[model samples]
Target: MNLLKIENIQYSYGKNTPFEKEVLKNISLEVNANDFIGVIGHTGSGKSTLIKICNGLLKPDKGQIFYKGENIWKKGFDLKHLRFKVGVSFQYPEHQLFCETVKKDIAYGLVNKGVPEEEQESKIRQVLKIVGLQESYLEKSPFKLSGGEMRKVALAGTMVLEPEVLILDEPTAGLDPKTTKQVYESLKEYQAKTSSSIIVVSHSMEDISEYATRLIALDDGNILLRGTPAQVFSNTERLNDMSLDVPITTSILSMLAQKNPSVNTNIYRYNDTKAEIIRLLKDVKSIE
Candidate 1:
């Protein structure tokens, strides 16, 4: 079943002002329960604006947003409930951290939800582990942590609420390779444990190719492509036209296919590409 639906959504900034501009135009999409969706686009393609609308942070100038078949903007609708159900962690989430202690920062959502003080501690600890942070760091000021740790603390704050649909915008924006992998793995583990729908907005084609079950590519405020990673990545030409790159391994495979028609160019993951190369080498040796 579709957990969320956006139909014909059009959003504009500064509506009637001289600086007015439309950021999203007639966008429509469905997010199914437990689906891992990746949103990709060049900067200013409205990725952030679209998700803010999804969580009811911004009302669209036109069209409807439905959460479980009910329009979120319906008169007298309780949007606060929807906000809790669909948690959004914005870009540079650490910038949102504002508690004296990491534990308090992580428990902020729980407190807002009116969860008991005793339960808040348990939930905070659980989400802290889910975000791959040590319990020892909980008492430190969020500002005292490294960039990566601060990001995890910010993430833990959102996950502690146990939202049914978690939306993260550039969750690993500036981290090193190892830290990026850790963050992605933690997200995957949380999804697996909770069966929650996850929407990640990222520019890393490799990360999306490896983790996202579905992909959506935006251009000029419109959806240019939507499909599985394999389906979307296969259209390398179109993505390039949108000023987006495919996974590096996919690019390598494409180059290999140019020199050797026998090599499979459909590979995306490093492991899959490595296996195909080994098989091809074995075939060449057998012929020799």
Candidate 2:
């Protein structure tokens, strides 16, 4: 089922002013339940604007946003309820963390929703572990943790609510390789466990290639492409025209194919590319 649908959404900044400029034009898409959607684009492509509209943080000048088939912008719609269902973690989520302790920070949302104290505590602990944080760290101030830890805490804050749709913008922007991998793994596990829709906006094609089941590429405030990773990454020239690159593994395969035309260059994921390389090597060995 489509958990969310955006229809002909148009949005502009500084509307009716000298600085007025449209950031999104005729954006339309449907987000299915349990979808892991990766949104990619160069700077100023309206990627962030599009997500904000989805989460009800920004209203589109023209179009309708439907949550579970109900128009979110309808006069009597409960926007607050929609926000809970479609949780968003913006870029630099750590900057938004404000509470006495990590526990409190993560529980703020649940508390607002009037979740029982016992339930809030249970969820806080559960989400902390999901984000790879130790139970001991829950008492520490959010400011006292490392950059990666802070980011994880911010992520845990959203996960505690168990939102049906989680939207993250640059969730792994400034972490070490180890932390980045852990974050991706945690998000994957979370999606699998909850069967929730996940939307991630990232610049790293590698992340998209590995984790996203679906990919959306935007340019000039328009969706240039939308498909599975294999389908979208296969259009290398088009992505390049929009100032984007395919995954490193795909690039490697492309180069290998140019050097030895017999090798398949159509693969996107690392594992698939690795298997293809192995198969080609085995075939050459058998011929020898």
Candidate 3:
């Protein structure tokens, strides 16, 4: 089933003023169950705007957004209810954390929804585990934690609600390599366990290539490419023309293909590319 659909939606900033500018133009996208979608583009490519529209944070200037076949902007449609079904964790989400303790921060949304206190505690524990945080840290101040831990807390806050679709913008921004890996691992586990969809906006070609089941490449508020990571990254010239880059592994494979036609340049995943190179070396040894 299509979990969310954006149909020919257009958005602009300063709509009627002298500085009016359209950020998204006739953009259409559909998210499905258990989808791990990556939205990639350079700055001002409307990646953030599109996700905001999905979360109901911003209204489109033209067109409609549908959640499970229901028009979200139609009269009597509850935007607040839509948010509970589709959660968003914007860039630098850690900065929004304000509760005195990690437990309180993660429970804020549940409290607002008037969930039972016992149920809130259970949900908090479940999400904390999902985000890779220990129960001991739950009693500590969220602000005192390491940067990565704080981000996970923010993520846990959103995950406690178990939204059908999770949207994140620059989820791993400013994190170290190990932390970045951990964050994605947690997200992958969460998606697998809940069978929920995820839409991530990231600048790291490498990260998105490694995890996303599908890729959407946006340029100048338009979708320039959309496909599996391999299919989209194969268009190296098109992405390069827009000042975007393919994954580092993809670039390496492309270079190898240029030097040796026998090299398989179709791979984009880091592990798969590594395995392919190993296989090629084994073939050379056998020939020798």
Give each model's whole-structure lDDT: 0.92, 0.92, 0.92
Better of 2 and 3 by TM-score: 3
- Candidate with maximal TM-score: 3
User: What are the clash counts of all predictions, listed in order?
Assistant: 0, 0, 0
Span of 10 residues, lowest total lDDT, candidate 3: 251-260
Query: Candidate 2: what lDDT?
Result: 0.92
- lDDT by residue (tens digit), candidate 3, 1-288: 699999998999998899999999989989999999999999999998998999899999998889999999899999888898899999999999999999999999988877899899888998888888899998999999999999999999988888999999999999999999989998999998899999999999999999999999999999999999989998999999888998999888888888778888889898999997898889889999
TM-score of each: 0.98, 0.97, 0.98
Model 2 spans > 4 angstroms off: none
- RMSD of candidate 3 to the truth, in angstroms, is 0.8
Model 2: per-residue lDDT, tens digit, 38-67?
999999999999999998999999999999
40-144, model 1: which lDDT tens digit per residue? 999999999999999999999999999998999999888988888999999999999999999989888888888999888888888889988889998999998
Which segments of candidate 3 are over 4 A away from where they belong? none
